[model samples]
Every structure is written in C-alpha cells, then in structure tokens.
Target: MSLLNEYRIRLAQEQDLRAALEMKLQAWREAYSSFRDEGFFAHHESQLDQQLAWWERGLAGGAQFWIAETGDGKIVGLAGGTPTIEEDQDTGVDIELGVLYVLKEYYGTGLAAHLMDTVLSRRDALLWVLEGNARAINFYTKHGFVPDGTSEELVGSWAGLREQRMVRKHG
Candidate 1:
C-alpha cells in the first residue's frame, strides 16, 4: 500500500504521549539542527517526564492534541492548540497552534497545510513560525496568517532559533 494511504489523523490521548515525544524529539533534532547550535542534537534526548507532564496538563486543562499516525501506529505529524484569552478586547477567544510537524519523507504531501486548516476551521487562531524556517513562514502566509509583532521563541540551549508569531482572522 502507498505510504499516504495508510496514514491516519486523530486526537492524541495519554497513551500516545511517549511515542509522540519521541517523534517530536527526532523530528526536531533533524529539522532544527541547522537553525540551532550544532551541540543540541547530542545533548537533547527525548524526556519521558516531559511527555508525561504534557499529557497530564492537557488532560487536566481543556487542551487538545492531534497526531497523524500511520496504520502501523507511527506518529508522523502532530498539531495542538490551547484555549487562551488575549489582553486585547477586540479579539476575544483565542487558540494558539502549538505544534505542527511531519516526518521528512512526508514533507511535500501537504500534511502541514491540511492540519492547519483542520485546526483553524474550529476558530480564529494564532500561531508562530520560526523566522529562519522559510518553508513554514511561506505556508502560514499563504494560508492568510499575518504578522502580529510577537516573536519570543523558547529556544532550548540554542541561539538564533526563535519564534515569530502570526495570526489569522476571518472577516
């Protein structure tokens, strides 16, 4: 069967936390190595505790996470958003798109766009793309996200890797 044919997208549960973290760590290591310092790949190992904490927080809070998995149960991509209220009275009810990724092999299959559309369809949301990641910036801009003047990324022990925030509005 074709690789795309066996892929599935579904809401992630607590049971999927470990695998999901592994997927994130692996993908990040591979993708961000260039944008980040060279030593990150050697030191940044996937942490089980971090994954457990994330699962706990999502279950306790109203956060939801989605994962795209293969028929054999391998996590290929993940996208998550959370309920947040911004200070601005103009835009009430906000959801932040926290994560979106696909394995290298599926990079050109339109998975990221599909995931963003799926998430954004639920509400007017905000997300950020790394400044150096041209591909992601292009994808977000093409989908109608605009610059919101926010750029504070949580770079883990790496320099020059930060976030540039963007938002999408429906008139």
Candidate 2:
C-alpha cells in the first residue's frame, strides 16, 4: 500500500504521548535548527520530562490532541488546539491552533494539511508561527490563513526569534 494510504488520523490517546513528543522534538530539530539558536533546543531538550508530564496531564484533562499514525502504529504527525476567549477578541476567533507538526520525512505528503484540516475543521482560529519559517507560513497561507500584522519577539531562552500571528476565518 502507498505510504499515505497506510496512515490514519485519530484523537490522541495516553499511549500516544511518547510518540507525539518524539515527533515534536524531531520536527523542531528539522524545522528550526537553521534559524533557532542552539540554546532554544537545549531548553526544549531539558524540558522533555516536563513536557511529557504536561502532555499526560492535558490528555487526562480532556484537551484536544490528535495524531497521524502509520499502519504499524507509529505516530508521524500531531496537531492540537485549545479554546481561547481573549486573545483574538477583535477578530472573534475562539480557537488557538497551538501546534501542528509532522515528521520531516513526511513533508510534502499532505499529512500536515490533513492534520490541520482535522483540527480546525473550517473554524475561525488563530495561531502564531515563527516569523522566518517560510515553509510553515506558506503552508498556513495555502490553507486560507492570512497574517493580521501582529508580531512579537519571543522572550526567555528564545529571546531573538520573532513570531507572527495568522488567522483563518470561518468559511
């Protein structure tokens, strides 16, 4: 069977946490290594256990998280969002697309779009993307998202990177 045909998207379960974490780490390394300082990843690596715990806790709390898994049950992509009331008040957006990531090897395979479509489901939502990530910006744009002229410099250990907000209206 084709690789695309072998994968399925479903709501993430507790057992999928480790694979989701691994996919997040891998996607970051592949997508951000060129522009992000080593310290950024170092911080993320140091927080792996904490992130895992957070994932478990969030899952237990009934948060929305989904994963694309292969026939062998290996997760290759993940997407998640949460309800937000104040962040996009001016635009009337109620959901925040917190994350949408796919393994590097899965790029150009329609998996990211699939994950995004599944999460947003044509709802009005907002998300922030690192300013220089052209690939992500393009992907979001292709999916009907447009920049709303909002930008913010990241703080803490990732102080130098800038993030831009993008919004996809209900259609």
Candidate 3:
C-alpha cells in the first residue's frame, strides 16, 4: 500500500492553521538546513502568532487554502492561493500560489501535488520560490510553471537567500 492512500486533501479550516504552520516550518527546516542555522528557524518560530493571525485574516477574507492530513488528522502538507498582490504584474496572472509545503518524510508520496491541485486547479497563477530550492522549482516546473525572469532579494533572517517568481498561464 502507498503512503498516499493514507492521506486525504481538503480545504483547510480555522483549526488546521496551527498544525499546517508547524508542518510548514518543519518543511522549511528540512529544506534549508544546509545554508540556514537554527537562528533562522528560531526567528520564524517567534513569529508564529503573527503568522497565524495573518492566516486568520486571509481565511476570513476568502483566501483559498488546502491541507493534506492523515486519517488520524496529522497535517502533513498545505497549499494556499490568493489574488496576486503585485500591482505591476504585466502577465495578467490573477492568482498567486503563496504556499505549498509537505513534510519531508512524505516527499515522494504525491501529497504535495494533491494539495497543489486542490488549491490551484488549472488557474493562471504565479508563485515565488526560494532561488536555490531546486526540488520545489522542479516540482513547479513539472506542474507547468516557468520562471518569468523576476527575482528579489530577501531581507532580515532570510537575507542571504533570494526569491524567484514562476508563472503558469492558460490560454
């Protein structure tokens, strides 16, 4: 039996935010451990409440979010999409996939893809990914997203890393 069979993906509710955020943090820690130290995660950990509040507001405002959980209700993956906030975006992409993360233990189980499809479907969308995260970049590329040549320097605890934008357009 496959691990994917043990999971279900559905729209996230208010109660799921904390677990989803913690799972996201774990994913980040696993993915960036090579270049980032404990301080980086510690800074993010200190801001969990702020992040939770932001998610609450976004959810209240109708931002779409999805989570992948086990039968026992352990959240292992999450994805969210919202209207693009880039005022100068020229591609006319209206949706921004702001988050898509899965626990490292489930890396090849297709849970991430299920969460992504649940949130994004076939919409024309854009997402910003850490520049050196080849796994994420490749996954997005496989899902029809391609870099649009836009990049930005991150600040604060993320100072050394950069973000690159990728987009998928539907005709």
Candidate 4:
C-alpha cells in the first residue's frame, strides 16, 4: 500500500484547531530551527492560548482549514485559505493560501500537496512565504506560484525575517 494511504485529509473542526496548531508548531521548529533559536519557539509556545483563541475566532468567522491526520487521529499537517486581506495586492487573485504545514517526517510523502489541494485546488491564489524557506518556495513554485515582486519585513517576535508574495494566476 502507498504511504499516503495511511493518512487522511479532511476539513478541520473546532476541536481540531489545537492539535493542528500544535502540529504546526512542531513543523516550524523542525523547518526553521537552523534560522531560529529555542527562545523563539518558547515564545511562541507561551502564546498558545492566544493562538488557539485566534484560530477559534477565525473558524467562527468562516475561515477554512484542512488537516491531515493518521488513522489514530493525530494531526500531522494543516492548510488554510481565505480571501486576501491585502488592500495593496494587484495580483488579481483574491484567494490567499494562508498556511500549509506538515511534520518534517512527512516531507516528500505527498501529504503537503494533498493538503494544498484540499484548500486550493487549481484556483488562482496568492501567498506570502518567508524569504529563506526554500522548501516551501520550491513546493509553491511546482504548484504554479511565482513571486510578484512584492515583499515585506515581518514585525514583532518574527521581526528580521522577510516574506515575499507569490501568486498563481489561472488562465
């Protein structure tokens, strides 16, 4: 059997937010450990309650989230998309691929693509990715996204990192 068969992807429910967020945290730790220190992760962890509450509100406000989980129900990946909130965007696409994350162990297992399809099946969309995240950038590129020459420097705890906007325009 294929390895992808061992996992399932489905729309995330209210109760699934915490696990999805936790999985995302693990993914961030694994993916960005080379650029960030333990303090960054700890600071993020300390805001867990606020993050959970924000996700709860987003779900209640109609944000869509999809999660990949094992047969035993442990969340391993998550993806979410919503209407673009950037007033300055001239990409001509309103759908934004907000988040896509999978545990490092699941890399190259096609789980990320599945999650991407769940949230954005061939639609014209846009997303902002961290400048140094080559893995994510390459994946997005393979899926038809390209940088639109727009970029921004993140503020607060994520200060220092730059993000570039990518857009996939469907003909």
Q: Top lDDT: which candidate number?
A: 4
Ranking by TM-score: 4, 3, 2, 1
In model 4, the worst 10-residue window by lDDT is 85-94
TM-score to native of every candidate shown: 0.83, 0.93, 0.93, 0.96
For model 2, where is the 10-residue window of minimal lDDT? 83-92
Q: Candidate 3 at residue 97, lDDT?
A: 90
lDDT for each residue of candidate 4 in 33-117, tens digit (9 for 90 to 100): 9778999999998888899999999889987799999999999999989888866367888799989999988889899999988
Model 3: how far is 115 from its true place, Å?
1.0
Scored against the true structure, residue 110 in model 1 reaches a CA lDDT of: 74
**RMSD values, in order shown:** 2.6, 1.5, 1.4, 1.1
lDDT of 1: 0.73
Q: Write the per-residue lDDT of candidate 3 for residues 128-148, one digit (tens) a residue.
A: 999988898999999899999
Predicted candidate 2 versus true structure: per-residue lDDT over 75-108, tens digit per residue: 8999999886575677678888999999988898
Off by over 4 Å in 3: none
Q: Can you give the lDDT of residue 155 in candidate 1?
A: 52
Backbone clash count, each prediction separately: 0, 0, 0, 0
Residue-pair clashes, model 4 = 0
**Best of the candidates, TM-score:** 4
